[model samples]
Target: MSSQQSIRQQYGTVQANALKLDEEKAKQSVDALNTDLANAYVLYHQLRKHHWNVDGAEYDQLHDWFGDAAEDAETAADEMAERVAALGGVPVSGPAALESHATVDFEGEDVYDARTSLENDLETYGDVIEAVREHVTVAENLGDYATSEVLRDHLAELEADADDLRGFLADDTLVLESAMH
Candidate 1:
């Protein structure tokens, strides 16, 4: 019962799949999915942090919004990871690896007001959406229609979330000492 003997596939190597997709093309799609997976996790952690620290006049609404966005990020990550495996590549794991592959940087420990938090979240969502859009194109070029479809759906959801965050930021009516005053 040796650990070495129990090992199966290795990371960064694409194995043969029943889907009949070219190994080279699958590798390309896998790389794209892995990157998206990393981005999704970064978004998830940042959103969770905001969810925990959200306060001020919009505390309840922002808290719920951040929590839901975090959940969506988690779900997207899971789907991307599974897709990576289906493409015959190992899904990237570990914080270090995820951070290395991530296109968006994680928002650190500093807790800001709800408006600022929403602003940061919107920026991160925009980055994720952009990356997802590129990956969708990559999947399409590689003939990985399933992967393209998955990323397309996530892209729509991310855009919707970003729009919601924008709405929250737009309503800055809670400010004191108005410019008109």
Candidate 2:
């Protein structure tokens, strides 16, 4: 083959490979985002429930905090769905999908005590932060810097929220007691 034809063939092969790689990356991102989105939705509902049912001396404060958390989780879920759509993937929205994808579980029909509910929320948020961190790693490996950056920001925010909730749940004295116990 002539030099020009050889160059053209090589360019075509490179383009095909790049396209394949992009598709693969999108698939991986879609899976991770969908899982995170489902978990976020579950957490949002749980938080809303806690907001409505929390009582006792800290009722007002806990209600407000849980309400804010639910709002944030809803927003995060929406953003994840949008990101999946932007990547040409459909967001998983079925009940089975949510159940299978969610990493946290909330049990019982009654509203948990303030401490228990807050602890559950903290654990759920921690799981989400870890999941986002995994997604960030995948994005980085795929050379999808934009997605990686977004996931990193999300992970940071979730981690901070979890830490704040944890702090509220346990004062220094409580922590010291727990350590001694």
Candidate 3:
């Protein structure tokens, strides 16, 4: 076979479904979904780093908490990637490729204490939720109901995790702050 014929690629080869909707629009939605997948991976990395590096009075607790968050992020990433494939698009990946599609940056360099880690993870979750919220509409407008549903589910999970983290960070023995609600 010729070099072109022998080439193996996951992208530029997507054959969007003919009977569902506009192929071009489906590809566009898939591209956007791949971006979310990348962003979820970056967020997962942050969660893991914070989980293992956390220190201070609540070291053990935060460590466990971040582990759960990391697991959730991993789940989100896997779902997003699958959705991309289901839409006939390849999942954006690799450290560099993921970074290129990521909606937010990860803090891989700095050493963070428990408080700082919570703040950073909360912020990252917020960013993912924000992007997912927008993608929900984008996916729906493109007639991609499945992708829209995925984005909506992801948005809810991320928001719940963020709320949990915020409550843990803000809940004081004497002053309950906003966690009471």
TM-score of each: 0.92, 0.79, 0.86
lDDT per residue as tens, model 3, 55-161: 75566777898898889888988998887776666778778888988989997778876677788888888888888888899988888888898888888889899
Comparison by TM-score, 1 against 3, better one: 1
Q: Comparing candidate 2 with candidate 3, which one achieves the higher TM-score? A: 3
Q: Which run of 10 residues does model 2 get worst, by summed lDDT? A: 9-18
For model 2 the TM-score comes to 0.79
- Which candidate leads in lDDT? 1
In order, candidate lDDTs are 0.89, 0.75, 0.80
Which stretch of 10 consecutive residues in model 1 shows the poorest summed lDDT?
172-181
Position 10, candidate 2: lDDT: 22
Q: Stretches of candidate 3 above 4 Å error?
A: 1-5, 8-13, 174-181
- Per-residue lDDT of model 2, residues 1-181, tens digit only: 5566433332101122333447667777778888888888888888899998897666777789889988888888888877776665777777777888877675446778878888888888877787888888888888867667767766776887798797778755423545543
